[model samples]
Structures are given as C-alpha cells and as structure tokens.
Target: MSGIPGANRQAPKPDAEGAGSAALGPRPATLARYLTIYAALWKNSVTREMMFKGNFLLWIVVELLWFALQLSFIGVIYLHTNRIGTWTQWQVVLLIGASHFIQQIYQAFFLINCTNLSELVRNGKLDFLLLLPVNTRFVVSLRQVDLGAFLNAATAIAVMAYAARQLHLVLTAGHVLTFLALCLVGVWIHYSLMFLLATTSFWTIRAQGIVWGYYNLFQIARLPDEAFRGVFRAVFTFALPMLLVSNVPVRVLADKLDSSRLPLLLVGMGVACGLVSEWVWRLSLRHYTSASS
Candidate 1:
C-alpha cells in the first residue's frame, strides 16, 4: 500500500492474490528499469502535452530560439577576436556546437529524467517509486520522458556534422571514436552536475540557480580552455569543470588535443557525482517529512 498524492492518505495495497503483486518481482535488468521509468514518464508527458497543443508548438519555437541565441553569442565573440583563446573560427564553432550537442542529447532523449528530482521531492510521490520492485535510481531517473527536447538534440547533432565539414577536418578512426566517447562523457558530466544540482532542491525546495548557473557555465564552452590561464583554469578544470562537459569533445575533434584525460575525468566525475548525489537522495529520504501517509 502507498499514499495517494494530494489526499495524503496511504492507498490500500493490492492483495497478494492480485496479479500486480504476484507477477511483479525483482527485475534482473537494472538498465531496463531505467528505460521503463522513462517510458512511463514519457507516456504521462505526452498526455500532458496534448492538453495544450498551442503551447507545445510554442515550446518547440522557444527551444529553437535558444539554439539560435547560443550560435549568435558565438558570432558576437568572433567579431571582437579573430581567434578565441587560440582556437580558430572553426574550432570555436565546433566547441559551441559540441556544448549544444551535449545539451541536446539529454534534452532530446531524457526529458523526464530531468524533471524527476523536482517532482519526487515536491509531490511527496517519491515513496511510490521506492515501493517499486527495482533499483530506486533507475526508477527515479526514468520516471518521465520529453520528446521535444529529444528532437532538439537530434537537430544539434545534424548541425554538428555540418559544422565539422565546414571546418575541413578529416577525422581519423581513432579521433572519431574518441570524439564520440568525449561527447558521451560530456553528457554524463553535465547530467551528473545537474543531478547534483537537482538534489540540492531536497534542501532548498527551489532549483532556480542550478539551471541558470548551468547555462552560464555552458557559455564558457565556447572559449578554448587555453584562454583560461592559471587560477581560473584550475577553477574550471577541477571545481565544476565545464572542460569535460563541452571543451574536451571539441578539442579532441579539432585536433587541438591528442591526448585528453577527458574520458577518465568524465568517468571519475560521473562516479563521484552519482555516488554523492545518490547519497544525498537517500539522506533526503530520511529527512523527508512526507505529509502523505
């Protein structure tokens, strides 16, 4: 039995004789759990979207505007400096494009995952997920999907490919593989960072700064890490490193960096973020004074 939302009353559990109780057991595939959460959430989001068709188109237009704004920001940079932090025009394009690329992947493919943190915390609905017969992380992360954001990511990839061609860069097999890997790492890092931010909502009850801070931090991706010297470099490299999220992929693809520790950095950061954010999630559960019975 679990509590119903809003009513703040525990709902009666299905009896042992019920099929839901008897058929459901521990799922062996942890990844499948994550995907299932996403599926369920996406189904809900689609239903939500249908309630406002005009707003859905507005959301699409808004996302496109955001993409255009980012590109325009890069354009403004080129006007002042021919080369930003030693990166050529093509490199800057790729760098910005890569950041957008990493961003799009998540927005496009994993929309519901982003909203789970807030929904779980605010609605006191997380307990239902906790009762589910699966790994909680997978359950929580995949509770929703956002197709609009996913489509945005797809467009970003297409743009990245076009940008790469204009740069006249001939990517080697190793380079291509490495670039793809870095993009993955970048997405993980960004996700981990957001995860960290979202968990903060458990304490703050509001997540305003995180999204804005991430957007501002993303701007740094347009400039090469080479431009940030000394202490500033250390800040980005270690404390909240956008280097891994956006810089590494572009650098590797641009042939500026032959040996990047970005992948290792990503994995290490991912592990660290996952472990800590998860720890926070668990701690929050202990602190969760749910009004729901």
Candidate 2:
C-alpha cells in the first residue's frame, strides 16, 4: 500500500481556503483588453459587410438619395421665406447636417447591435455573451458596424462644412471641439434611450415595437428646435429631450446659444440618461430568464 491513502488516485481537490482565494482573486478584463476585443469585433463586422458588396453599395446610394431629398425639401421651404423660426437657410442646413451626423453615427456604431439585444435575449444567445470574460454592456454595444452609415456621416460633415462657408461663420478651434463633444453627447443620449428600450425584452419577449416607437419619437429631433412651442416644446425639451440632442450642438456652432450654462445642462442630461440606462439594464438582467431555463 502507498504511504498516503489512495496516493495514486486523482489529484487532491482544492482545499476550501484555496478555492475561496481563487474565486475572489481573478482580475477582470482591463480597459485595453476590452478595446482590443472591440477592434477585432469591428474588423470582423467590416469584413462581413464587405462580403456583400452589392448590398452595401445599394444602401449607400439609398442613403444619399434620401439625404438629397431632405435638402431639396429644405430648399423649397426657404424659397417662400427668408427664415424659419429665426434660422436662415444655411443655419437650418447646418442643423440638418448635425442631425444627420448624430443619427448616422448612432446607427453605424450602436443601433444595430443594441437592437439585436432583444433577439439575443429571446433566443438565449445572451447566455453565451454573459459567459464571456468582458464587460457585457460594452460587448453588447459594439459587436457590429454599418459602413454605409459611416459614409453617410462623412456626407453630413461635408454638408456642415459647406453650410459654414456659405454663412461666413468662422469656426474657431474651441467652437469645433465643443460641437464635436456635443455631437458625441447626442450619440450617447440616443444609445442610452435605445438600450433602455431594448432591455424591456426581459419582460416582453418581443420589444421591437418599443424600438419602433422610439424611432418615431426621435424623428422630431431632426427639425429645428424653434419649430416647436408651448406643450410640444416643454415635452421634447424637458421630458424626452430629443430637441437637445442635435439643437444644442447646432446652436453652439451657430453661436446662437444665449446662456453659457446651456452646454453644461446638455452634458448633465446626457450623463444622467446614460447612468439611468445602465442601472435599468442591470435590473433587467436580474429579471431575465434564460431560454434554457
């Protein structure tokens, strides 16, 4: 017999102390690791989209046509009047460009991935995502990209540049930086709202209706902020804040914002929405019943 009982048997099980230490000691993925993973994901998405070259080109053409039509409509409106709610043709064009920039970037980076979350939950694919050693929110937000939408964003930037030139608006470095920051804040607001809506899938197996409703509501943001008044203004300005999404950035660029604190308020609102969305997502995860279960 061996000196120890079952000496040739399987290796000894970890002791309680050792197991507890191991359980508590593993480090989470670092920020750099997360960025690396996201880069890989984006590379794969671009590859997949490129594989369907015809479809990609078709989408690009369709988006360009739609944008052109929007510009034509704006031209018609300006034909009858010199200004719409104190916004000149060029200023309103700038606003439209800003709206398109925000919308296209949101769609390219976050919309598709976030919308798919409901499907992942419905089919229990989210379980695999949960098992991955990464930040669930970050992974969920950036697993895909729409190259065509990025092309549209570039077009919007060109339009804004043209409008700035036409208006003879001198854009300082500070003005440009502030506009870009506010544009990002607009994107964050859109993502936060969409994520919150998608998380409703935890309770309602198919929450696409809510997503569509959000699209309908957000369309109002495409118009100039001065176009709304009274209850409409109060509702979109304070309650939902769709107006603030593109309007604040446009105002900042146009040098039309009267109050210095308006930008701060916009930043605060975006941060508050993002934080609330995160909390709601965690709460929804707790309520989620995996398809396997």
Candidate 3:
C-alpha cells in the first residue's frame, strides 16, 4: 500500500516553530481532529468570502433568480393541472424546496472541493493533499465552503416552511427532525456519487464532462418520483437512486409513508453508494501517477 504513488502518507513533522506546533500536537483522536480541521476550514472560507463582497452578492443574486424561475415554472404547471402525480401544488413545491436545500447544502460544502480533485490531479496539486495528517478524503471533500450557497440553502429552508404552511401540513418536532435527517441522507447520496465521478480524473485526467453529465441526470430528481414509470423509474431508483433523494424526504414530511420499507431502502442505497465510492477512491489512489513523474 505504501508503495502506491498516492497512497496515504504520514504528515511531515512540523518545524520547531509555531506553525507546525498547532498541526503536530499529540495527534488528537480521529473524530476530534476532523472536526477541528473542518471548523478551521469553514472559518477561513467565510473570511475569504467576506473579502470579495461583490462576487459574493452576485452569486447570491444569481441563485435567487434561478430559484425564482423554478418556482415560476411550478406555478405555470399548476395553472394547467391541479396536481403532479399524487402531489398537489404546495406538496410538490415542498419537494422542490427539499431538492434545492439538499443540492445547495452539498454544493456549499463538498461539490467545489471534490470537483477540484481533477484539477489537483492534473496539475500535481494533489501531492500536497495526500501528505496531510488527516484522512485525505476528508481533507479534499471538506476543505472549502461556499458562503453564498449557504445563503441559498437558508432560502430553500424558508421556501419549504412556507410551502408546508400553505398546504396546512401539521409538522411536529419529530417530523421536522426526521425530514432534516433524510435530507442529510439525500446529500450523502449526492456526495458519494459526485465524489466517485470526480475520482475518475485519476484515470481519465479530465472527467469534467462526466461530472456535468451526472449533474444533468440529477435534474430528474427535482421532479416527483411517480412521474416516471417502468424502466426509467427502475434506473433512477436502483441504479442512480437520485429520485429517492428529494422524494423520500418530501413523502415523509407529507406523512405519505404507506410504503413502510421506503426509508430503509433509501438509507441502504445511500450506505451502499458511500461504501462503493470509498472503495473506488482508494483504488484510484493506488492507480494514481503524480504529474511530475
């Protein structure tokens, strides 16, 4: 394993100075170290975002406009039909809000960082990431944050809340908590899939096209799962499992859990994808040849 070019390597010892002292402290427990690193990265990301006020505001405006357009489209569809599949106007809006929330959360935290893996591999920047003391995957996935996307996430939450109120869906504390948990599972599924795609750069040297294609496929999840049938439904539900991301959470919120097994199925799929992605990443690492070589 150690012989592999990009295999896990011990972090170099810090110099006697203060810089290394902070990172080299008697290695903290794994979870503690990971949390500490994530916190620091999040702080740095917020600080950096603040330094570029114009860009930050621009992205926020663009995201708002995009979400508004989605809502307008939904309104237009409702004008023609009372419901989409089994979902009513407000219910479908809830699903759309859930989708945006999960997508933005993933984008804010993991997408930017993971997408950079290809660039890192192509330009040899991955050398530094591989040498970090922490788990390489953790470092690569959580190293950056998008503050603007975080704001959009908040907007999505507000949309969900408003939609729920409009629908008169009585949401208890348990319902809210469960919905949030399932949303996190949805984000995990997305992260697992996208991370897997990004790792392909290790072999292809350029996998952006594949990444974009995956994103396009993910758009299907924004619609109600019941809108598809037969083979198309099976492909997304079992193979890609994108539909389950937003659909399951929205169903749970709407108290439409007649399919008692759906939650377990969604969770099982997420765990499966996560494990497979991790395996693929390790395999990619073993196959990696540094750019300088």
The total number of steric clashes, by the backbone 3 Å criterion, in model 3 comes to 0
Residue runs of model 2 more than 4 Å from their true location after superposition: 1-29
Each candidate: how many clashes?
Answer: 8, 0, 0
lDDT (Cα, 0-100) at 234 in candidate 2:
91
Q: What is the lDDT of candidate 1?
A: 0.64
Candidate 3, 1-293: lDDT as tens digits: 21111123322321124225544555444345556777899899989999999999998999899888888899999999998878899988898899999999889878888778888999998888776655577677778899888889999999999999998998999988988888988888898899999999999977877787777865788899889999999989998898899999999999878975888888899888887987888788888888977
Q: What's the true lDDT of residue 69 in model 1?
A: 87
Backbone clashes counted, model 1: 8
Candidate 3 has an lDDT of: 0.82
Candidate 1 per-residue lDDT, tens place, 38-84, comes to: 57766887998788889878887898898888778778878888887
Provide the lDDT at 219 for model 2: 69
- The whole-model C-alpha lDDT of candidate 2 against the native structure comes to 0.80
Q: Rate the local accuracy (lDDT) of all candidates.
A: 0.64, 0.80, 0.82
lDDT order of candidates, best first? 3, 2, 1
Candidate 1: list runs displaced more than 4 Å.
Answer: 1-38, 109-116, 208-212
Which of the predicted structures, 1 or 2, would earn the higher TM-score when compared with the native?
A: 2
